[model samples]
Target: MASPIKLHQLRAFVEVTRQGSIRAAARLLSLSQPALTKAIKELEEGLGARLFIRHRQGVQLTECGEAFFRHASLILEELRAAQEDIQQRLGNIGGRVSIGVGASVARTIMPEVITRFHRAYPHVKVRVLEGQLVSMIPELRQGELDFTINTYYHASFDNELLYEKLMEKEYRVVGRCGHPCAGARTLQELMQCDWTLPTPRGSYYKQLVDLFVSLGVMPTVSVTCETFMSSTSLLAKSDFLSILPRDVIEDPILGQQLMAFDLDLPLPRATFYLIQRKETALTPMSAHLANLFRQHCRASA
Candidate 1:
């Protein structure tokens, strides 16, 4: 009978595929190049397949390697989850929970939730990664992120992810006090003002464009900001107008710096979701943090 594949071999194979070079993988794994190479060789021999193609610059996964990578990644993730599960079951409140969140959620909800969570689970570390949803979704699937709290559109489109709506958010047109457009009562008037908008790739940006399209007016974008904070800051100190979430402007700090104007036209409501992998089980710390977020949403509502 063939010998059982070792954990180190699997680790080596996965790391090589991820790093795309044995030298880099070896450095990451804290192993010698020859040792890492031997591990990959043993893994290929055990599976009776070539996992990678060696090249001048680095290596690329073969078809079989790609197939194996998915399962290998899941296996490792499951093992880590199991370890966390066992630790929590033993009455240890220590573990790490990684999350992907957007700028608005990060600024508003996460601060309160994380504070409460940390007070409760003092030993469990929480790591928050902020990015666009397009990039963060894959991390959630790969088990790198415990969950994501952000606006999600077309919840049914991605079957691999489970999206539970946390709350519906409304946007308001905002600018510094005494701005010219602050007196504008309708969407058409606001369209005439220069705007500081979010990056075009975000859902909010699309919503902004769709809003103007529905009104048959073109928006004049003066600047495109990568984050809500930047846009808010820009709006606070300049004549540029921006559409921001009610929660964001309502926050005491921002409230002091900016003012919201009533738009005559209805704006699209954003649905914030708690997104997670369909097949992955949540660790105790992760579930608790998620509950904290839900509780925060409810309390704020």
Candidate 2:
């Protein structure tokens, strides 16, 4: 790769190109005309290109200089953003923070996250994206997402991201209201009916499967849905039971017509965590928002 271009040289070039004279550029830069000239000459030498023409009418950029200037401005702009982002991290102030979350957490925690973040920093914008835990890890590593809420997939992964347990949530069996098995007491009785749990490969799908396995029964799943809304809708239409988090099963709008019952054999209790890249430094706003989330969880607990 080529050596990085110097910012001083670019600034001098931009000043001279805009002002049309070394004397004018020097005045603007608070430097002597000879110093400005020398800087431009060094810049051209470093790049192995002639950047300007010295004409009596005034200076004009060579084709190479014009292209370099365009890129130089963009680099400077990005540098500015990086500097500001770091400063914001040093002390909470301003910056964009991107957070990814699982469907379950999004439903239970988003309102508090948004309300508290805005109350503290009205100027800083928070962007929340929703996805399964399976997609969150890759997105965080790629810098597409700054942080996320997920479970420890494995011991290796648990050591990779900075994971903090936020809460432990239990899965309850849910069905449309007035369903005959809504009042069922036994896991065997519930497992005999059709089910709409997540597919085995989904993020928390294994929790449901493991539950039935421990009971020495296989769930008679008739359909597998990827999202909570889809599975809930299926349950409302047919006599299918689903394993859902308490938040969804208690949602007034979505759960009003649904009945939730505790499993006779204990269902899996899943841990939800707040995670961020171990190597990435959190911006001030991001860190502040994270603190607020922790406080909210503590208060709720």
Candidate 3:
């Protein structure tokens, strides 16, 4: 049987179609114009079809080329998927996986997750990017990161992204060990004090905001911090108050240094969710790391 057409031909075709000029495509592909022309001629001969029209203005794809372009994109994507699958199968889970996590998850949960993951698969390298929910989905879509842990809501990529509920925890009003809000009796009473809050884009923070709106009052935010660590750290040293999940307050390191105040009205309950790219298959290492994260969250609960 004749050998399959070279990937170089497909690459050349894709570049030429995108660039819209053989000379431009040749420059983009780092090939001489004549060499590129020969490659395209050979490809069209093998395929038994004309793929492009040469013009003084620029090249235009033939009807067949348009269809071919669509197939070529799918082929390249599948090739990537296959490469990742093989790497996983070979048990070479040493490649980098970029993950995004909310500030709270990074502070309260990721330490244990990372430690256990590394212990089991020391070869795999993990890079965790901490950011708000607003940026997480965009970053994931851009292929800048693999997955993230955030609150599950209506998402544009809901069909292609998996959101797994990790756990549920209640909110607590917390302040520095010496802050006065630590002794406040009710929402009305606590409202009298200054507060630190995570940005409204934060899933929990949104709930916090809605809870106040429902109560016919909006709590005044004294300061806004980007991450839980920064917000909590600020609460540790200042008289400012912040609302946090019960799990974070219950954490030994943070719990010992902060105090939770009683509130007259109940705060909204928050559910934590783990967001990941939908995968029919993943590298052996990525699957293991994901499993490790789930296992650890279960253990913590």
Candidate 4:
């Protein structure tokens, strides 16, 4: 009978794949080059398939190797979680929970959620990863993040994940306080003003463009920003206008710095969603954090 695969072999395979070379992986793993090669060879032989294509430069994963690498990485991550869980359970409550947040949600809702959670579980480490959903989804799938809170996109539904609607948000066109067009009551009047827009590549930007096009106007974009915080800061000190969610504009600190345009144009409503891998079970701490987020959203509404 074939021997069962060993943990060391799996570790070596994953490290080699990550480092993209046996020498670097060997240095990191503190294993001799020959021993690492032998471990990989044994693992491949045990599985009855080649795992990597050896080359003078390094090694590249075969199709089978790529598939194995993903599983191996996930398995190692779960093992680490299990160890941490056990350690926390044995002593005071403490484990790490990593979450991804979008720029808008991060500014509006995360403050309350994080403050309450940290106060309740001071020992537990919390990590917040901020970025666009496109950049965060891969990390979420790889089990690097426990969950993500972001504006919902239709493409998010294309992934095998569970999405729960947190709230429906309406956006307001905003500019610096006492700006020339802050009192503009019509879309046509506001269209002439230079706007700071979300990056043109994002779904939200497309929605903004579609909203303006439907109104027979093409927005004059002066700048594009990936985050609401940056745009809000710019709008505070400049005459640039940008669309922002009601919660974000109403934020106690941010609200003081900007004024909303009174345009009657129909704008797209944004829905925020809490997303997680459907198959992965959330840790107790992660589940608690999600609950805190839900509570904060409800209370704010």
lDDT of 3: 0.75
How do the residues 1-301 of candidate 2 rate in per-residue lDDT, one tens digit apiece? 2345688888898788779888888999899988888989888888888989889876899999888866665455446447768777577477677888777777787788779789878878778887666666655654556688755455345555787888777777788888987778877887688887665543566656665677698977778787766877888888888877877778888777787875566667778788886766665677777887788778767
Ordered list by TM-score, greatest first: 1, 4, 3, 2
Candidate 4 stretches with Cα past 4 Å from truth are 1-3, 19-38, 47-64, 85-92, 156-159, 200-206
Error of 4 at 216 (Å): 3.7
Angstrom error at residue 293, model 3 = 1.7
User: Per-residue lDDT of 89-168 in model 3, one digit per residue for the tens?
Assistant: 78656665667877768877888888988887687678898876666775554444656777754546678777788776
Candidate 1: tens digits of C-alpha lDDT, residues 219-294: 7887888776788878889889877788888888988889989867667887788889897879988998999999
Measured by C-alpha RMSD in angstroms, how accurate is candidate 4? 3.2
Report, for every candidate in turn, its global Cα lDDT versus the true structure.
Answer: 0.83, 0.75, 0.75, 0.81
Please give the range of 10 consecutive residues that has the lowest summed lDDT in model 1. Answer: 150-159
In order of appearance, the predictions have TM-scores of: 0.88, 0.68, 0.70, 0.82
Candidate 4 or 1, higher TM-score: 1
Give the CA lDDT, 0 to 100, for residue 238 in model 3: 81
Q: What is the lDDT for 237 in model 1?
A: 90
Off by over 4 Å in 2: 1-84, 87-92, 200-202
Best by lDDT: 1
What are the RMSD figures for all models against the true structure?
2.7, 11.5, 7.2, 3.2
Q: What local lDDT does model 2 show for residue 135?
A: 62
